[model samples]
Target: MRQINGQNSTSTIKQYSSTLLLMGSMLCSTHLLATTTATAYNANNYNAIQQTMLAEFALAYADTATALHNYTVLAIKSNSTTVKQRALNVALEQHDFKAALDIATHWVVQEPSDVPALFYLAHIALQAHEYELAAESIDKILSHDPSADLEKILAGIAPESKEDQTVLVDALQNSQAKDNPSILVIIAALEAQTGQFEQALATINRALKKRPNASNFILMKANLLSALGDEEQTRKWYSKASRQHKSNLEIRLAEVKYLIKVNDSMLALEKLEKILQKWPKAEEALFIAGLTSIDLKQYERAERYLVELRNSSQYQNDAYYYLALNAERKGHYETAKAYYRLVDGSLYAVSRQNLINIYTEQQRLNDALRFLTQERVNYPQHASFLYQAQAEILKKMGNKRAAIGLLEEAIQHLSDDPELIYAEVLLLDPFVQRDRLDQLLTLLLDLEPNHPAYLNAYAYTLALQNRRLDEARDYAERALEMAPDQASIMDTLGFVAYLQNDFSTAAKVLEQAYLLNDSVSIGVRYARALYMQGDLGRFAQILKQLQQKHPNDPQLAPLNSLLIPPPMPKSS
Candidate 1:
């Protein structure tokens, strides 16, 4: 038992006492016994006991005095060198860094030629961010034989360690993980994150040998393979898991889901039907069956599955949401509204706001306002819904003050997140009180000088105000450089050029942006630039095209109702 400061932990004894408090607590046998017990030496049981011991030790050593007392006892109970090493590891995990160092220092002095002891100390120093101490510890290991294989490995290795991640990364990269298969799985997971699909695939294959039935390894390997566009192999691994564990219904369903993703809906449907036959009330299988139908565009089958699911009293957020999409497609706004409401006021609020679009499109202004009011009541501080509601309602009512007030409220949550601050600046740009927004912008530069959103927002605001076009132009260029292909960034750059009467450059940039994403806002700005440049022919072409896409958009009225003046004839 580890001590705290100087006190002997009656607490370690307290845990063994508390273990009797609920000897029948929720302990999964699978966690304690990964396989049928043939011997007492089970790694899974060892793992469980190790985790529980770690928890107890961490609590006991909250005071350093108690930790030292336990360390002295531990030093006598086993081979001094080996047991002392384990104590150092436990101390480090408990965040008693000085104690870990003290133990390591003793081990080094007692066994001056112990490479493992020196390296352990090096790792402890690294964890403390004592890079100088870490280097010195490693140097002690290298001094032993200078040419030893162990010394060569530690010295040759560059520790990009990146914290606890170092254990897995160093284990794999240092080529020491062949002896410890658990390290192989950690390496596979790390490589998967870094987009090294091939290396990740090979590592997972190696790890499966040590624990062939490790579900996490199989699932991760399947997902990584899927991410690399190998849908066939992804399903194969899931099927392999299914075959290994005959009664694993969830894992078998994972295989079915993968088939649906790969466009083999018929095969996925067969599996879903089997799952239903086995357990008729399996809501997940039913949900996926409906979703698979939706993916295949078999709308009739999707409607049937969804209707049956709803009748059976299954939880159906996805089903209801997709059915809402189905209703919207069939011009049934009232039906769509009901399903959308089920998902409305949820932490996931996008489903409801999308329904607002339908209300807006149908010109049911009262319904849209009612929906917005309800959303405001639900998520009181969610800036997105509040701002959208304010923007829509105030724009409809021509109440700029109320709209700007809502936008400003949204800005308060966005003080540290530069993107939100930038959006707030644009929303406030029309107001006379620019000082409030300018304050946020100046604070933002100290945080994110090259942020795409900040660069574009500052550029566009300066351009719109017709002040400091040179500064605006530079910011716009910087925004484009940060995110070259982003449609909104390109629009800012084009608008900055337009403000400087560089309309030719504006037309080029804006046209390129419009090609990438035909956003109504970008279209309006680009068309306006073409008109400013006296290129009304090009402007009219773009305007006519844009109006067709956004027929009921309020901005479309200006372009459509006003006849374009005739273009001067070209001299051949």
Candidate 2:
């Protein structure tokens, strides 16, 4: 049986067993059985007692369906709230959402003030996708307790379910609680979470009118304006809110964050300085100030702020990481290494990667390899990534053969780790070792068939061979379906289209892909498609841009040849 909302099935069954025992004892009471007046009344009482006994018998034997049916009938016939609640629990335990909804609705109708029943009804309705019923139940809940946590109640709805959220939003708008500031706040938050910035802005304005000095609402308005692409208005609102709530640290910090987001590092630093002056020990403000100083290339100021936070429990690792970054920027290699070593927790992997990069940059390949080998032993959880890093360093040193061999060795010990396998597949020459590449891709697809990256790789490899265009297109389309926004997958699809001689479709998708990512490979493909479509103007424009941006890229050599004028005839 499935656990409901973290409630253990065994415990729920035990609770139901206890309830059945109590009901059994009540039904077996001699006094009640003998107190019947009319024959008809006694007959009905006998039937009820027999049904209760049967329900108890079914529950005792773990026959949940039988118990649920009897309990549901008993709950409807009797006005006992306890029976109704018991029936609802049985329905929930059996994973019968339909029955649970029915019982919960009946319970709420019988006892409108029952908060627990109302809560169950709301959640069950949401589970059934009955958004309007859920909204109505929520409105009832808020009517009883204005302080109800609507956010918590609505948290079960997936954030990506924008349609359901829209229905819920509309239902709430028509509710009697529409004017309630708390409800309006929740509505605005839902709207904002789903990217309805204009609607969110309007809803938040309504909430602010009800509670003008609400700091969270003010920040929401500013964020919504930012989302709506009105940066000027966003900046104005942030400034206005900061001035109005001068003592509110959260509002001030939000304004500082907005400034940093807009690349106004100097202004952000100034704001952080003011906040630090008042709340001198505010670690968050100090951290932001340190990062902002780094952005502005003020290393000394960054160090000053970061050093003060080195001992902070919450920001210690982050402070060390940034301090390492500061030292690295100033060419203090030893100091940077020492600070990086001090970094731990979530930043540890990043710090180690940076250390490896420094070694590679200084041409200390042996040292980088030694450090990675030791790190793999010290942090075994990161072994796969460390091996990949080692392979990258070897490949950078012009030993692609050794890199592939090392990955194969790693795979032997790690038992077919997909990352190592994929890394090795990428290192192989697709044209020379087509069969091996295909084999690895087939294995990868078997392991993770729906992985968009693997699908794109397989599709691109097939397209590169200029064979199996149909199969390649299928895989590319599947990958695009899984990750619609990924430009690389789109490029693969476009490449497949190009190989199939569908230049129109190829140009359309490749143009979008180039616009999204603009990698050298994607740009080349887009330029080729445009050229094939006879759009010489667009083709020339893209080719020129590619040459300017990537003059040394080998892929551009062919396109550059097209622009060369024919040699003049010597006879002329």
Candidate 3:
């Protein structure tokens, strides 16, 4: 309700604007040209005048760009302080910083005592990168209120780069407010961002001496020590802070947060439990506890904490989302679906995704497709994703023919989205339609030559066919270079070497791949390489372990053929 001029936000601007309109209507009835011409006019004339004023107010909400222009015109024509402030608000809302600065400067000139005007002037100056002007405005505010806290204002000056941070620090240090502890802390935080950790520690320690019991300084010092890699000293300071600030919930919560960051969930949960013992219904503590429980795989405890959060209106939607996850983790499909349906707002999209995943896992393909169809209607721009989701469900159901047909139809509509095209290539049968498979792989490689998936798939396919060993080796090598830690790509390189009769190299690469992934396919390949290299004992050991681990996997038949000699004694 604050006036656009320098008034506090809680002021009754709506009431004042209404009174002004009523007075304007009354004056229009007697002295205005249009109404005065109608001598016998009644409420109709006053209603027309009221409608005119209402229309102007409605314009402010209808279209921001047009409203800004109209407000600027009104301010110029009437020279009213209120109208100028309205223009300023519109300019700020539109992110037209130059216009906002001009309006705010005019407001200050007209109403010199307006503190909000000066603050906004500084804010706009900072955004425009007019550092000197920003400093001048900040100094005016500090001079106006000697005890003003510039922390919140300075916090807005986020520098995205080292040079930007240095510029901001220099600008702020030159200001009269530089002597404030809050300003010193802001500068120290910026210094830390620029990797001047030693300078940051010195500045923060200086501030702590000035205000020894300030929790913020203590926390900052702890963070600086952590950044400097002094773990022991950091823990000491954190413990000291919690002991000194026993009544401060934020200080206690900060310690728990640091513990969680360092992956010390046991200690974090212990501190959280102690905090909850005192304030059982604290929303933030309950939320973090719910997340920690989920991370620790305590589904029941997570559900309990998240359900308690449902009582707080602010976290109702978030609580429902977490509750859905808890039920999903417990394999309570119906319960999770019910919880997901109750979720709304920004969580709606993510909850819908979870529901799709749950339906797919449960093999309720129709339900998943139904939800995706509705989602496609709701978000038409995401049609490509919805199509791919349907195809994925078909693929999971072992209906590759239907999945391929769906992708073909989708490509006709969407026309060569690289992701969809790549997906279609994955469904290609290399044995039945080698030509078509090669064609699609070639197009995919052309689309994204450096794509690790494309490179690995092409290399693995060629290795399988044994037609282009050198090309396959090159592609697999490129894929390994691109994703050095990818187990599948490493297996591809091993398989290519095996096809080229490099059994020793194949054994080494497959061994690495097996260690990286422990996949049955990689283990079988490693076993085969060892068998071919005459390491019969090691091959037998690996094959036995694979049989025990996989228990009659059909994919292990080739390795089994190599291991078992087909009843040679029975012929004798």
C-alpha TM-score for every candidate: 0.52, 0.64, 0.58
Clashing pairs in 3: none
Candidate 2 Cα outliers beyond 4 Å, as residue runs: 1-179, 187-213, 221-247, 308-316, 342-349, 430-439, 450-572
Ranking by lDDT: 2, 3, 1
For model 3, the stretches where C-alpha displacement exceeds 4 angstroms are 1-98, 159-168, 206-218, 297-299, 311-390, 404-572
Best candidate according to lDDT: 2
For model 3, the local distance difference test gives 0.78
Model 3 is weakest, by summed lDDT over 10 consecutive residues, at 6-15
Q: Give the TM-score of candidate 2.
A: 0.64
Q: Count backbone overlaps in model 3.
A: 0
- State the lDDT of candidate 2 residue by residue for 1-572, as single tens digits: 11124121212222445556456546644446567553424555566667777887798899988888988887777666556656777777687878878887887888788776677788778766787898789889887887554544555443358787788788888988888876787788888888778988999899889788877778878888998999899999999998989999999999999988888889889989999999999999999999889989999999999999999999999999999999999999879888987888889879988988888778899888888888888888878888999999999999999998888888888865788889988998889999989988998898899999989999999998999999999999999999999999999999999989999999999998999998999999999999899998899999999989998999999998877889988995
lDDT value for candidate 1? Answer: 0.65
TM-score of 3: 0.58
Q: Could you give candidate 3's per-residue lDDT for residues 510-553 as a string of tens digits?
A: 98999889889899899988988999998989888888999879
